[model samples]
Target: MRCVANTGRMSRGECSSIRAASDVGTAVELGAVVSQWVGRVVPHEGYMLAAVDPVTGVGCFLAREHGYSQAAARRLIVGDRSDGDHPYPFDRRARQSRVGVFNTDAPGLRRNEAMRDVMLDQGVGSELRIALAHAGTMWGGLVLLRPRGARPFSADESVQAQRLARDIVAAMRRYAAAAPPEPSGLALPPGVLVIGTGGGAIAAERVVAATPSAREWLDELGTRPADALTTSDPPVESIVWILTQTVRTTDKPAMTRVPTKRGWIVLNAQPLTGGTDVAVTVQPAVGTDLLPAMAFWHGLTPKERAVVEQVLEGLAAKQIARRLEMSPHTLNDHFKSIYRKLGVSAREELIARLLR
Candidate 1:
């Protein structure tokens, strides 16, 4: 229905359809509702719906059908190739399209009538388009189309569609907010570290008093053996000695990486943070386990191992590809192999293994 001229009114039937279709919950349910709504509102040969992530700017196709539900029309917007020879109208640039209500007969529609032609190519005729927005953000949208001889969306129908869009936005936001946070991947035993300037030793002392392990460590710190070389010249060495000596009496592995002016040192164990800040932040090249090592090995092909060695040396994929005279796709294929072999899911895991 033509949303711009509808004056935002809805008949009982239209209202019922809108309400029934906009009650989105899970992604699957949302896909079903959107498909049904498109079938009801658009007269096109096919239809589809898409939801865009607000934070990540990634667009995901929600639903599509070819002959009966504006499916061709939807594919034109999303560049899904199976919809025969129909040309895609929308591209990545569509994200920047201005948001507002527009008449089906407006000049903007005429200028951008590739959307209309795609429907016509599929034997559908007219169309109604509406932009969905929430808190000024364009998060998702619906495009309704009708066959050439069919009636366009009435002004009343368009208004109802806009209201439905608002409801969908609210539902999506609530669903996203209530979702649980994903895990961070790192696992640690129950313990807390007190970190501060040297002046805050009292706070550290209090932490030690409250935690039995910390109390024992601090008590041991005060009774260093005469053979122990006490030196403040290398702050990192001092910290490493303290950590190692305290944890040596216990079964737990001691903290192994201590920051030093030159870089960092591997204490009783090997360095996990690597020797560089970038590696430390991005992959922490230390404390990794077997899965990561396997994933790394699996991600590579024999020939690509040379490229991967450069990657390990901190070279960008583009640079490595260029140096190896290989396409980025080839490099990517190697990485996928590496990921499969390593039994881990990502490059970060491989990097973590190297660091660890």
Candidate 2:
């Protein structure tokens, strides 16, 4: 018995050691991934990695080797824009720099340096900014800095940084999928299950088409349309609400709402899944009201309305294409027309104007 107990203890120690080593390995892998783009920029003396909360318009520093601390980064990126009650201009210039599009040659970096002093009391060296945009919002960003006397980012470096920015965004998406849903007030994790007669088929087809992985689980279900509808965990409420309210529809496609702990869970059910398949989209019922803007935005042409609605809901061009059965290039054209008519340079401005 003693011998067996000793052996078990040894096995447990080895298991713990292996787990620790695995964690260290993962950290190294993440570092290597970032390192791949270092020289592609301006000799990369240091870098800042940050994640943005789309809903709150907040940026959180995930990692940084630059002089700025997390608090400093957040304050600088999401600082007050009011300028003492005089309304700030709505142009792209008004928006503070978060991560992408930083240039050593431009005035933006000079402004950032001034703000850095007020917020953090530190000055950043020459740097290149790159942002990770997903689901229509800038979710993460990277800032690669060079010490004094280092070369500014060249055109080639900027292009390489953009490519690296894309990888960072992809990594964040994977992280979000793997991370467990945080605690919520609801009994179940918020999710929408679509159900309807012909509606269910249409909705299911749309969902499966939009999310390829959904097909794997949906394929195992019965073929009967009604059988599929019957299998929905939650009964349908309002079709218009589910379609328009939950999943913000664009002329091209519909997008899933940003997941939240306290929000509505929408599900759609219809006989056919050919059209829009979003059965449910979760939205906050209490504090924020997006319906007024959504109504106005949806009043535009199906295509125009779709683009506007997705913008209001905070989805990016890539996500819109997936939901709408169109290419990103096509969606960009639609956005150009939408912006022209609305007289807005960016989606954020359009949303802010409509919501007001």
Candidate 3:
């Protein structure tokens, strides 16, 4: 219920609209709502909204308007040659604050080859970036762009955008809390699902020796064989593909967690020895793998999480109370709060939500 700082131009109705949008069902619906809000509030010609992987800072889902060419978008998404040199890289900004503005007229910007090319090609002059973070993990981002000669975004506007981003994060957490339990029919047990990848022209990129489990996990993430070229701008690549590509090119291990209808699935990649190939392992995330993010998404306090962990381990209420050195009454209160925040009525439901 935090209010936007007094940005004189915002109407009471506009604020209410954003608050309502926060309760929308999915990230895509929320993005569409925010796009309309930004059009009226900050006045931008182009926008990009992404659900990003916090650990790897890679996009898991994206929607954009008036976007860069596929070439440029790929560079930006993969950090090929575009990101590290930018004045306000997403990774660096994620560590500092939720909102930032970048102007092409800034001294060093024009000197940056990647930044200069994108701005020149897109005919944009000002960029406002919002990193939507909650409980220390970034879940998404919003970027707004204005054409050349438009006034640069001001400090006050950045403040306004920060407030909006905060609301967006809050909504995302609630959505996560209410997400349906991971499907059990898939019965994909907790084990390594192997996938192999080769890099080159999009046509040449391929998935080799992918198992049925691997394919199921890939399908859950909406991934296709690298050759299934879609006609969309910034052609889609699953987080698995992205991690494999990252590991192949960087010669290092790469890992990221992606949200799926089933739950969070962990993708881990490593350069396979003796070739230009990478191996990616996909599996259901364990409690440790998902704990911090679940805590963040459900707004659970540390004590509440401790109680949940014990409950997941099949502890009795009294045993948990004794272990945590809390009275039975206090333990019950914590359970109540955890259940409410997580939108679960009992320990079994809480375990299902968290354990996948």
Candidate 4:
């Protein structure tokens, strides 16, 4: 990854502005507040703030966009997914530099297979990508886009974005610790969503078919009108397409847990017709799917989560300490912190909260 020298600093007023935005609370409110602030500082035509999955590096869970058409956003996300296959993927680049620039005319664009074509097609000249990570865990990402003929994002502006990232991501982490969404009332069984490509000079993609229950999940997710399915109108459709691409490339099932307003739903995709098409199944997320996210929601540090895992296995404190290569005193301290953060007083309480 290339490193940018710190050529400038943000003013105290600008720093305070970001702090205020972080304090606004909730993912939606944070996006609205921070997007406006970023536009003022960076001069972008479109903005996206998303809460991404730390493990998968996918941002379909919770996202808010402004000033971008549905079609454009869908294409951009689909293109970004293919970028994941690059030798130097977005997550690694983001880890190296919290803020980075993407230019359509750069020589590196050719190395990026999918993003280049999408950027060219969309007439996007430049993009500023900010990784919303805290203490080595990625909470989400922010993207600012400029159209063709616009000036490329400058090094100084990138420095400003880097400065703003810490506060913004810290707020997003707090938002992640909030309660999970409620359960969807509909008790329908798991359903299928089929995806395939049409014959064209450029293989246009479409939703080939979907089960009734799958359609219910789409409606529950608030996807665009039925006409939009062929073109992949909503963000959810972008996620489905991304999973399809993954299944085709790896010849293995691809899966993700999507958090909707009602609750989390598991989406699993498998290749069909020798990878010519992909079938995605939608169902309620189970305990395994919810456990990792549960630790995140309670703001458990990685080490603390390790301790919780041992507890779930019914290990004694001394046994867990020995297994984790920590002293009993240190283990006790971790327990105290976990209990305080989770608002639990005992091991049984902790288990109940986690299982629930």
Judging by TM-score against the true structure, name the best candidate.
3
Model 2: per-residue lDDT, tens digit, 71-150? 45434433423132212211112233224333334333344444545432544445566655643445555666654444
TM-score, model 1 to reference:
0.35
Q: How would you encode candidate 3's per-residue C-alpha lDDT over 107-128 as one tens digit per residue? A: 2124255656667677877778
lDDT of 3 at 351: 77
Which candidate ranks first by lDDT, i.e. highest? Answer: 4
Residue lDDT tens for model 4, 1-356:
11223334556886677665555434556676677666556667766776655655544444455434656665665555556553323342345336778888852234265656767677777878887776666666787777778778888787778767776766565554443422334488787877777542112457777776777776554433564544533223655665676676678887765555445666788877655777888777655565566566457778898998888788888899999999989998999998887667888877654444
TM-score, cand. 4 vs. native: 0.72
**Which lDDT values do the candidates have, in the order given?**
0.39, 0.40, 0.62, 0.64
For each candidate in turn, the TM-score is 0.35, 0.36, 0.75, 0.72
lDDT, candidate 1, equals 0.39
Inter-residue clash pairs, candidate 4: 182-262
How are the candidates ranked when ordered by lDDT, highest leading? 4, 3, 2, 1
How much is 10 displaced in model 4, in angstroms?
A: 5.7
The list of candidate 4 runs beyond 4 A from truth reads 1-30, 62-70, 73-88, 92-94, 103-123, 131-134, 138-140, 181-188, 198-204, 219-236, 259-263, 273-275, 293-298, 314-332, 343-346
Better of 2 and 3 by TM-score: 3
* Deviation of model 1 at 202, angstroms: 65
